[model samples]
Target: MALITRGFGGRRRDDPNLPPGQYRTDDFPVLSAGPTPRISLDDWELAVVTESGERSTWSWAEFTALPADEPTVDIHCVTHWSKFGTRWRGVSLDTLLADVETAAEYVVAHSYGGYTTNIPLEDLLDGQAWVAYEFDGEPLVPAHGGPARLLVPHLYFWKSAKWLRALELRLDDEPGFWETAGYHNYGDPWREQRYQAD
Candidate 1:
């Protein structure tokens, strides 16, 4: 499968954050399903759309200008590698959506190049998720979802869609590109939800 690229990072087996069937990697890896989209800051904008089609927008400057939080968390990829102690700086998804209201129970995170992923709206709240722009104190790189990306570390990395643009709230769950193709709908790393049994 084009999506499965495994790298063993020689991490300790005792690390509790390392999910089952995962190895620790100190170095970040670059994996993408499509060509890297170069979104100039001038043209970059993040939109939030409710199930009823209500939309709220945040431009590049406006997004970065918000009060930022630095989250230290571990990142796990479905490919079997996990990065521990990964630090990021960005506005919490809660902070971004504070002024917006939605009755939706789920979310479809859409990105450039038509990449999308499904995430539970509840999983994104209460400081669990962020629209991260900087990683390790550097502006995110395109290959690694630079400029901006959704950070949902509780799930597989793919759910944290790269090159993120809009988040569409939904009352029902729908599979995104990878999920529909083969990956699990709700990717919990600890449970090893890489693919649902066929």
Candidate 2:
């Protein structure tokens, strides 16, 4: 039996800003591989581990103290939904990796509740990504990767890991949770890379 979802297979709006096969939606959908993690602000920390085993740790206060950037970007998901002009504020990856010494070319974002996702190092640099704590001028809620989440707008929303915890720099790319489960190793919505075959 084929299941039909409302507004999923309905009429298509002519929006050139949206990627191919994606429908623009005002609603921010909540999708997760597991239950939402309830991490306290006081207990939150972000770790950046270099390939050489060097580690830089930042408490919640220290992270929030860093310079932040406000970005209005379009986010696309693997499920064919695109949200445009979303406002976010957070510390850029350049700011985070500026002092960290590394020769790695890739990063695997580790998140709370054991969710993981891999992204190229270059994709995270040059103001391409951020560890976002606020959405739409308000503090993010747990259902939306609360304390902080990796915001990589260029790629599929899955690449923007939720509930970001630690980021491990790697010399070579390693497939993370979704990648290992038949999802594309690198999810680029523009390319429609959703499954392993993509």
Candidate 3:
């Protein structure tokens, strides 16, 4: 795993497709609030747990050694900018799921910054989702979610949890941090489920 760092800042680049500004949560087309979740764990929490409770942990080197594939796909942010032809690398979600035993109907993804998002098991198990370690053919920078991030291309970018830590299989659809706050439960980007349509 890449060493965790703070003070990572983002720069705005002129993308003909997006408005000119420092892109951030405020720039988000949809905004809402919710209670952030927290967890206290030791280094032993570093293991990946399969549905059947099989556990496997990886060091920085081992995690990076997993087979990687590049995906060139358009990325749509809930903040309203769509970056096209973005490339990412990491193990395919399907490949990772195959190693686990699960009867789950949903998934609750946990992140480092006490953020969580609930996604249907079907969505996560789909071949398109990935545990992305690289972006644009390079190791993903921290601000953009380095080490590993969850990529759910079909949903708004917030659904793509960054600084991912664990995947908790659930038997029910539990709203995550944003969902509980006001973001749509199923953030379908095409449907414009960016915020609660009040």
Give the residue spans of candidate 3 off by over 4 A: 1-47, 50-54
Compared with the true structure, what per-residue lDDT tens digits does model 2 show for residues 47-104? 9999999999999999999999999999999988999999999999999999999999
Q: Which regions in candidate 1 have their CA more than 4 angstroms from the true location?
A: 1-12
Question: lDDT tens digits, residues 10-74, model 1?
Answer: 44556677898988788899988989999999999999999989999999988989999999999
| C-alpha root-mean-square deviation, each candidate | 5.5, 3.9, 10.7
Whole-model lDDT for model 3 versus the true structure?
A: 0.69
Local distance difference test, per candidate?
0.91, 0.93, 0.69
lDDT of 3 by residue, 161-191 (tens): 8767878776677899889988889887666
> Better model by TM-score, 1 or 3?
1
Estimate candidate 2's RMSD in Å. 3.9
Q: All candidates' TM-scores?
A: 0.92, 0.93, 0.73
Worst 10 residues of 2 by lDDT: 6-15
The number of residue pairs in model 2 that clash at the backbone is 0
